[model samples]
Each structure stands twice: as structure tokens, then as C-alpha cells.
Target: MPNDTILVVDDSPTEQRVVVSALQAKGYRVITAADGDEAIEKAGREQPRLIVLDVVMPKKNGYQVCRQLKSAPETQHIKVLMLTTKNQDADKFWGMKQGADAYLTKPFASDELITNVTRLY
Candidate 1:
């Protein structure tokens, strides 16, 4: 739904733009953060329903952010989808262990992104 906001966290400008554009085109209220710390701040401040998180980032990483968010009562309700280039099975397992709702690798299709986001809604 357009009413639900999504926070996209990635250090890469191009990747951030691509994801933001795709989500905006799909009618979601999209917000963005360039790294993990910013992601955590925006997630707390904006209270977005979902967060599209990147694994490798400065200040902090997706796993750290997800773990912190899940542990905090204020942010524990937010859903996190790990969107990163880390495609290893261990990466997915660790992400899920940290409370990620979904794990999608890089080079994902726009439709797949939309579908996963919609499922979260």
C-alpha cells in the first residue's frame, strides 16, 4: 500500500537509486539511508513498516542493525528484508537469525522486489 513507508539502506548510490525508483513506482512511500547507522536512525525516526537493508556498510552492518532493531521494543515490530550482494547460505542464515523477514541477493528483478515488499505488507 502507498500508505506504508519503506526505508532502503545501502551505501551504494546507484543501488539506492534503483531500489528507491522501483519502490516509488510501485506506489510505496520510500525513504533512504546511505549506511547502517543512518538506516537505524531513520528507521527509528520514520517508523517505516519495512526496511530494505544492505549487508556490507560502514559505521555498522545489516546484521548489527537488524539485531539491534529486533532487540529494541520501539523498533522490534518493523519488518526487515536483507537486500545485499551476499548470496551465501551462511549469509542468509545469519540474516534470518538476526531477524530479517526476507533475504534477497543483489541483481534481483524489480518484480521480485515488488513481490517481496508486497508480501510484507
Candidate 2:
């Protein structure tokens, strides 16, 4: 089995498109959520193997979503990668605190993204 399903949670349509396209091209089954709450719901339903999440979004934010997923037994095993423009150390620190497996700053290289995701798998 390919086992490449990835849930991408980001509010920006442009960012979503870029990330989703890159992952899909790498043979990932991409599912998108526009915000944190939707991410939670979809995560429950889709149970994707990985999640690429954005930090800033309406209604809950990626950190909160990652925390919920990591805290819950039903979702804790799923890997989470934080992909956001917030490059501050505090931001990355907080993302990790919320159980993100990896953090990638925005404007990231496509190859790097692929490498990181592949490594997680």
C-alpha cells in the first residue's frame, strides 16, 4: 500500500494549492481543511497518515489542532508537520510543544518539503 494520505490544513487558498499540489505530485492522497476546526473534523473522519498544518487560521489555529490530535488516542499516532510563515523561535517551539513532528517555515523549497515528508513516513 502506498499509505500516503495527507491532510493539509491552511486558510490561504494559494498556500493550500501549493502544498497540496506538491504532496499530490509525490503520490500522496491530499485532503484539505481551510481552518483548524475543519482540520479536526476531517482528521477524525479521514485518519490521514500525516498532516501539514498552518499556524494562523480562523477558529482555532494549527497549534490547537495539533495539540488536540496529539492528545487524543484516536489521532496521536498521526504525524504532524507545521508549515507556516512564522519563523520565530517561539513559534517553532510552541508548535513542537503541541506535538508537531516537524516544522517548516513558509516559502519552503518543494524538494525539502518532499524530503521531510518522506522521512516522516
- Number of the top-ranking candidate, with TM-score as the measure: 1
| lDDT of candidate 1 at residue 50, scale 0 to 100 | 95
Error in Å for residue 69 of model 1: 0.5
**TM-scores across all candidates?**
0.96, 0.95
Clashing pairs in 2: none
**Model 2 stretches astray by more than 4 angstroms:** 1-3
Per-residue accuracy of model 2 over 15-81 as CA lDDT, tens digit each: 9999999998988889899999999998888888899999999999999999999999888989999
Judge candidate 1 at residue 103 and give its lDDT.
95
Cα lDDT, all candidates: 0.93, 0.92
What's model 2's lDDT at 37?
93
Which pairs of residues collide in model 1? none
